[model samples]
Target: MNSINRILIAGSFLLLAACSPKIYGTVQLVDANLQPIQAAQDSPQGSIVNMINTTGSIGQSSHAVTVDVEGKFESEKEKVTPGMYKVEASRIGYATETETVEIKKFTGKKIEFKLKKILEGKRATIKGAASDEDKIINPGEVSIQPPSM
Candidate 1:
């Protein structure tokens, strides 16, 4: 009779635990100088958008998350098993950066990303294909001269 009571109690505890949800840490975006910049002042959305994905080796894939605008980026409170995740930031015309994050049981984390110059060079060469033969030729080098538009 005592054994039966112990089994019932243990089963009930497991059931409750399975239904509970766990929360993970967050990520942020910064500038190349490590200064926290607010996402674009003209951001239509109030919250920063973060896109999360996997990378690296098998089972060792990292979570690549990106946020546009300069602000602290947070992930949805998810029930994730404790593990090491490679968190990265993605943005158009911005160099992406990655950071390692450890997800704990309860505490949320703050990750930051600095937006480095996305432009590889001040000038870009415009190449064209020569009709005479399948040859590549540099038609011209377009300088990134900011116009007074």
Candidate 2:
């Protein structure tokens, strides 16, 4: 009787394990120039990565994770189920980006977000003046001043 109970328990455990699928991926945040954004120590939550399982009902299956200092986020081990996920990355000063991905395995898929900087109010561009004997100013020598309220 004891041996039979042990065998049944083992089979049940195996069945449960087989039913659960593992899903994971990496989210990368970058600027318009394709430069990686690193999180500052002062602002720990540099960016937010929200994953919604679009395969099923909306809002019911959603997960939100914060990116690390390297502006990267990975799903927890076996925490996410295999399905179609709509991933979104957002930052305070940058435009939000979204992508629809199918996460079916545990492979570390890389998703990159190119966020454009949002400029508010007016922006002034000042060009550098020519100096010395050279009457031509250096090209691309432009400075952007923050908009004043």
Candidate 3:
């Protein structure tokens, strides 16, 4: 009976330990107008979501997951502890987005991140330059000629 009581206590502790909170969310890659970026092909998969536990030790409290094609992500069951976390989402050609959330035991929190596209500088082009057949003049080889009166 004594050994059985000890086993029961141990099992209860195990059950409690397995009931940690979870964090989930979606990371949408959007344009300047806040519209979802449509992929040329259906299988675009480079987005990443990270949850950093702000109240815990560094390196040990960071969790990361790759977003699906539709930008959905979820933490593993009972993988995250109850605490405050800083969630960040990022993808190529888009600016990273971040939000702070509090995780509670036996409950899940959902966060949404809308990333904006990074605007690139416009390329300079010389349309009618008399140099190459391509008609575009390289910046380093540009020559200004005075117009004949």
CA lDDT of 129 in candidate 3?
56
Model 1 agreement with the true structure over 20-104: per-residue lDDT tens digits: 4332233343455755546453221223333332332454332323343434455543423455555655555456666666655
Q: Taking the candidates one at a time, how many backbone clashes does each contain?
A: 8, 0, 0
Write down the TM-score for model 3: 0.65
* Local distance difference test, candidate 3: 0.79
> For residues 1-149, what per-residue lDDT tens digits would candidate 2 score against the true structure?
69999999999988776655433344454555766556441332457888788885654488878877555576665556778888888878778888888766533446766665555768799876567665655668967789999
User: In candidate 2, where is summed lDDT lowest over 10 consecutive residues?
Assistant: 36-45
Candidates, ranked, lDDT: 3, 2, 1
lDDT of 2 at 45: 47
What are the RMSD figures for all models against the true structure? 12.0, 12.1, 8.5
TM-score of each: 0.43, 0.53, 0.65
Better of 1 and 2 by lDDT: 2
For residues 61-122, could you state the per-residue lDDT of candidate 3 as single tens digits? 88988888777898876557888989888887888998899988777788888889888889
After TM-score superposition, the amount by which residue 122's alpha carbon in candidate 2 deviates from its true location, in angstroms, is 1.8
* Candidate number with greatest lDDT: 3
Where does the lowest 10-residue lDDT sum fall in candidate 3? 37-46
Greater TM-score among 1 and 2 belongs to 2
